[model samples]
Structure formats: C-alpha cells, structure tokens
Target: MYRILIVDDEPMIRKGLQKLVEQSELPIESLRTAENGVVALQRIGEERPDFLFTDIRMPKMDGLELCARVAEMDADIQVVVISGFGDFEYAQKCVSYGVKEYLLKPVNIKGFQNVLEKLIRTKTKVSSETFVAVTKLEQWASRMEHAVWMLQEAELKGLISEILEELQAYKLKLNRVIDILQEIHTLLHQRLNVRDVYLMQGELELTGAADEQEAWCRFTAAVHGHLEELRAKRKGKLKDPVEEAKQYIETHLAEEVSLEEVADFIGLNPSYFSQLFKQSTQETFVQYRTRRRMEKAKKLLEQPQWRITDISGEVGYADHPHFTKTFKKYEGCLPSEYRQQMGIRT
Candidate 1:
C-alpha cells in the first residue's frame, strides 16, 4: 500500500494524473492533490508519502525546489517530476535531487503507467528487504505491552535494545522506526486504558528526526519514565501475586504463555515473580509449567481416540516432532510405543 500526492498548478493535469493512477489498479492507500510545491511540502512534512508527483512549473516553489527540500529532510521519498518544459538544465537539476523519473506534459498514459509500475515494484522490493514487517512489530509491541504492565523495567529496556540494535544499525529509514514506536505507544495506551489505568502519555514522534538513533533515545527515555510511574502506582498493591501467577499459568497452559505475561497479569516484576513462584511451589516457574504440560500431555496420550498431533497442540507444542522428542525425554519412548506397551489398542 502507498500514499501518493500530486502537485500541479493545472487542475486538469492533476485530475488526469489522479485518474490514471486510480486506473493503474495499484495499491493506493491515499491520493491527495496540492496545487504547488509549498502546499505539497506542508503535506509532506505532516506525513511522508511514499511517492510525490509534481509539475516543474508552479507558483511560489517549483518541483525542482520541492525535490531538493524533500531530499534534505527525508531522501527516502520517491519524487516523479511532471514537467511541461524539457530543458537540459531542468533534467540535470532533477537528477541531482535524486529524481528517478521525469515526465513531459501531455503525459502519455502508457509512459505514465510505466513509471507508476516501476516505482511500485521498487517500493515493494525495498519494503520487503529493508523494513521490518508490521506483523513483527506487532509481536514486539505485544511483549513490550506486557513488560510495561508488569513494570519490568529491565525487560522493557532489553526488548527495545534488541530492536534498536537490529533496525537502527544503518540508515534504513525513519518512517519504519516511527511506525514501530507509534504502534508500541498505541498498544500500550489502549491496554492501559482497558485497565482504567491512565498515565501521562508522552509524545512519540520520529518522522521529524534525522535518523533512528534520535528516535531510540527519545523512545527509551519516554517509555522508561512511564515505567517509573507504573512502579510507583502499583507498588506493593497485589495480594499474593505468586498465587495469581500460578492460576494464570494454569488457565493458559493450552496456549504459549510466558513468564513475562504471567507476571504482567499479576503486576509483579518478572525476577521477583520468578523467585516468589519458586519459593511457593518448590519448583521454578519454567519447571512447574513444563511438568504440568507434560503431565497433561501424558494423560491425553492415554486416550487412543485423540491423535498425537492434536495432543501435541493441546499441550502447547505446535510441532508434533518436537512434542514426540519431548515425550521421549519425559516418558522414555514415543507416544505410540508407550500406548502399545500399556496394552492400549486403537
């Protein structure tokens, strides 16, 4: 999906280009029009579109100047020049500003569509190769949400640090990093709102930053500060967080539950929850959860009516072979072999 803005002084040209774009059957999330470079720059600053289509001749600021300004701020935006003049100097200026495609007015439908096709293909490839997928961001944000709720400052920092090390290693792009941070911020806000626990919502903006390092510094500072507030608000408030952790773990055994989420549910720091749970159960949290899952898997395997694959999923192991290996580790044989030894016939 893409957001494209058209900049042309002539209303007819803008409409024609917009129509052609609509007819391209491309994935266009938004199509906006600005009469000249100044308004286009204003819109670009507000939200960086994936592509900008502008005519060379315009009032106030020309397309050449707009391209230069965009390059100065965010060079990732692809600029396609639509000009009435074809002077060699204009071509040179556009090339200098990293303008990949330049179209002469009385725009040929085929040529224009070709440019659109090429840009979309290039963008799709760049997005796949360069940016982390939104789904991955969502998963990370899920963990961050849990960490924030649990007041696990260490876990929060660890998660953010891992992401920053990978994505911000080079100048990949700020928009992608901004998207991830904004997603995290939105999820945290929504989750906290659901609990009727509201805190100071700090500004999380990275689009205006020069690079992702600035984003990392600002995001970490803000989120860590929010964590301090959470710690203060819920300090020593839970009644027997260890027991709550146990109950949450027991109920979510069929799902891939984590210690962080369990601790988050009961509002205890993960390390503190680990020690408390071990003391209460005489087994580590991981040990207890695994033992319980194995116990349940064994009971399910005894029923010949349930398939081994289904039993594996019932015990939270999605991979049947891994479940078989684990079952061998626990029961000393394959599930089918165990059933046969027990004289259980299907």
Candidate 2:
C-alpha cells in the first residue's frame, strides 16, 4: 500500500492519471492532487507521499524547484518527473535532483504501468525486508509499553540501545529502526490515552539524513523526546495533594483546623505541605483560612436575623471582638460597619 500525489497544473490530466491508477490493481492507499509545485511542497511537508507523479512545468513553482526542495526535505520519497516537452535539459535537472524516473507527456499506457510496477517493486522489497523484523519490533514495543507504564527511564534507553546495536550489526535498512521507534511512539500514546491523558502529538519524518547513522540519530531523538514527554506526564499524575488540602480546609471552615491535621489528612509532612500550599496558592495556609472565614462571615452578616456574635462563631471565630478585629483587618471595616453600609439594620 502506498500514498501517491499527482502534481500537475492541468486538471484533466491529473484526473485522468488518478482514474487510471484507481482503475488498475495498484495498491494505492491514498491518491491526492495539487495543481502546482507550491501546493505539492506544502502537502508533502505535512505528510510525505510514497510516490510522486509530478509534471515538469507548473506555475508559481516548477517541478525543478519541487524536486530540489524535496531532495533537501526527504530523500526517502520516490519522485517521478512527468513532462510533455521531452526536453533533455529538464531530464538532466531531474536526474541531478536524484529523480530516477521520467515520463513524457501523453504517457504510454504500457510505460506508465511499468514505471509504477518498478517503483512498487522497489518499495515492496524494502518493505518486506523491514517486515522480517516485525515480530521483534512488536516484542520490543510491548516492552516499551511496560517501561513507560512503570516510568523506567533506564529501561527505555536500554531497549533503544539494544535495538540500534542489533540494527547496525545486521546491517539492516534504516526503515527497521524507524518502524521500531514509530511503534514505540504509538504504544506510549495508547497507554496515555487509556489514562485520558493526551500528553503530546508527534511526527518523525526524516529530512535528508546524510547516512544511515544520521537517520538513526533523528529517529532516536524523536523516540527519546516522546519518552521524556511520557515521563513528565507520569510525574504529574495522581490527585494533587495541595488541591485535596484546599478542599478539606474549605469543607471544615467552621472547625479550628490545624495545619498538622490537614497535612496528616493528606498524608504529607506539615513543613513540606506548608511550603507546597504557599507555592501553589501564593498565600500561607493561615492567610487562606482567615480570608475564607471572613468571606463566610460577610455572607452570614447579610442575613439580618443572625446575631453578630453567632456569625463570628459560625465562621470559626468563637470570640466576637477577635472576629470583628480580623474582619476589619481583611475588609477595611468590621462586620457591623459592612452591615450598616449595606443598610441591613441590626
């Protein structure tokens, strides 16, 4: 199966080629079209196609520029230059760009089939070679899944290291390394998805790697980046201690809540919990509790039927004078002054 892009300014020829490819028994998974090289480059950058059927002449950017750019972008794509001109100059430029196949316009039905079959043969050969290691890759991917679940960093690196060593020792194609990395990336995300955590989205299409070693470098970089993301997400997992403490404090607003009790309730040391609470809420726990009590008192004061002393007791302050003092300190006025201003007679 392959994804192919047809790049031509003429809609008729593009559609015709698309129809022919579809009508035939070619293993085309996707067939997309772009009017010119400019559009083609954008599409290819986003999602590289397996085979490219592009005309030499196009507006805005021609096939020459597309071929040159694609060479720099990704060397793995199979590019075929289709031209009506049969121009030697264009053919030379295409060859220089490392395009091996060139078809004249008014493509002979037989020649077109031959070119496709040839590209498919080359593609299938490399693909089958990559598949020979599919079983091992699946086993490795399963191990990677477990390592990520356990948040084992060294294990992940060891797995990738062993894979790279084996790939190099066997002199296998870079596709095998790419496949393993891809499988690991997928498995890691699948595990995260089960946790309802969409940690990151990743794509690892290689630019023109200078050699197999460079390709491996790019692939491993991507693989390790995903691993790093997974580790970060794991560290951020579980219910936050600070949030649970805040909830408990809010619910027990009427009680004389101590930091030690709150810390013990959340299973953390008082000193560390105090520091964490301040860092997260940007306020000391005492300050937060005092403010919350005063807020509750203000609402209680709005009800004219509740006595001022009773309101104080309801907000965790049993002493009326102390409650009034604290309320004035926080709100710039006593609760009685607040009631008076709101025209709630006491």
Candidate 3:
C-alpha cells in the first residue's frame, strides 16, 4: 500500500485533504500531514511517503522548493501540487519540477480521483512491462549457459539451424555470439570433462542461431559432424597406446595401478610406455595418473554417503595420511576442505 503526505500551511486545508484521501478507495496504508514546508520535510525524512500532496504557497519553503528538495532526497517519491491560485505560470513551474498533477484551490473531488487513478494505472503498467523484460533476459541467459555446456562436450552435429533461430529470437548480436562460441571452443580444447565439452559445443551451435531452440539443434549437429571427422582421422593414426593407457587407468582407478602394469597390458616396455605416454599426452605418466585419480576422487566426494576415508581408498590411496597430503598437493586443499568449499555434503 502506498503512503501519502499532505503539506499545507492552513490547518483546515490539511485536515480536509487528509480526510478526503483517507476516504478514497486507493490502497493507502498511512496518511500524514504537516502545516508548513519545514514540518513537511521533517515528516518526509521520518516516514518517506510514496506520494506527496502539498500546497504551493507555503512560507519558508514553497511547494515548488519542497518538491525540488524531495527530488534531491528521493526522486522515486511522486509529488502533486495543490494551490488555491490557478496561476498558469505556477502550474507550469510545478510541471517543470516533475510534479505529476496540479490542483487549483478548493479541490474537485472527482477530478482529483481521476488524476490519482491515472497515475496508479500508469505506474502499474510500467512495472509490469519491466518485470516481463527482466524475465525474458533471465531466460535468454539460461539458454546461453546451456549452449556453452554443449559446446564444451564437442557434440555439435545437429544443432546448426536451431542455434541460428535462437540468436534471431533473442536478438543477440552476431559478433558477441561468435565471441562466446570461440571461448567455448578454446575451453573444450583444454581437455575439459565430456559434460563440459558437450555444453561448450552446444553453445557454439547456438551462437550460429537466431533463437535459443535453433541454436541448440545446430549445436547438436555440429557435435555429430565433429565426431565424424575425429573418427575418420582416427582411422589414419596408429593405434593410440595412450588411449589404451587412459582406459586402463579409468578401469583400475581403485587398484594400485602403475605405468608398468599399463605397459604390460599394452605389450610395451615400462620405460618406452612412459616416454610414449608423455609424447602423446604432453604430461608425465605419474602426473596423468594423479590427475585421473583426483578427478575420480572429486566425483566421489559429491556423494554425501561416501566418507573421506572411503573416498581415499576408492581412489586407490591405501594410506589416509598419504591421500590427504597428495590431495592437498594437487588440489591446493585437503579433501575435506575441498568438499566444504564445493558445498558437497561429504
């Protein structure tokens, strides 16, 4: 409900205005009055009314001056001028001060009601429009986030046209969309998890669209196309021993696995496997193992049912102390601290 303040030098005028406003059907919760502009300013500072009705010719501070002061204090408050004099120049000055309405001396009850109703209706309409605009912006942002997630997964085979449509529907600038798509591509190239890569790929496809849905479909198509290309290339390259090593690491993450064991599985010497793994992955075998184990541990930590001790054992760390030390070294925090920081229940 809106709060109202009536400021006038005459006691009778203030009383009449207060009674009339209170009798109105407007959802006004509070009605306050002051005899002069100085007292009105004081009441305003105390209560901060949403609407102000003030006489124009008050001593010390006239209605115009009071309105100006109120604007400086809180521009959101609506001010209406009430004057016994019908001076056109005075009314013009009130308008200049951002007063919504001006009333001549001896207020017309029906006219005043009409003016108030118009003001309330206009305010409501503007607020509703703003809310709708904000909701659409939020939804567009959410769609963009989802698209980015798909792009990161490198799955952009069937979404090209859909992405184009989304861009158009959202009225997104083509250049900005392209920049976001490029960023997602770079992130995918960094070897993020499959989920993240998929998201990035989806976003990239959407960037091509004129609307959100179209962007999504385009992203899916792009991912499929990319996978096809990768498959064709894979046929030409020698069998990836590094890929075999990675698969072995994933399957035996809970076992005391080592490069020697992986080398034996692939029928390669331990020293050769180590060199080949580094050359293929640009990371040492031990670094790769630790990264893989840490990633698994992070996933397990998301489960509230798993204790830190059990998580450590599941990630192939036999000693709890050693697990804590290594976790801290790789993750820059103890396992428990990591879980807390991530808001994981475990």
On TM-score, the leading prediction is: 1
TM-score for each model: 0.60, 0.56, 0.37
**Total residue pair clashes for candidate 2:** 0
Clashing pairs in 1: none
Q: Judging by lDDT, tell me the better candidate of 2 and 3.
A: 2
Candidate 3 least-lDDT 10 residues: 199-208
lDDT of 2: 0.76
Pairs that collide in candidate 2 are: none
What are the per-residue Cα lDDT tens digits for candidate 1 across 7-55? 9999999999999999889787899999999999888867779989988
Query: C-alpha displacement of 172 in model 3, angstroms?
Result: 24
Q: Put down candidate 2 lDDT per residue, 24-104, tens digits, no spaces.
A: 687777889999999998877555688998998889999999999888753458899988775646656888777999888
Sorted by TM-score (best first), the order is 1, 2, 3
**Cα error of candidate 1 at position 280, Å:** 45
Models ranked on lDDT:
1, 2, 3
Output candidate 3 Cα RMSD.
Answer: 19.1
Instruction: Supply candidate 3's per-residue lDDT for 82.
Output: 82
Global lDDT of each candidate: 0.78, 0.76, 0.66
Reference-based lDDT, residue 158, model 1: 93
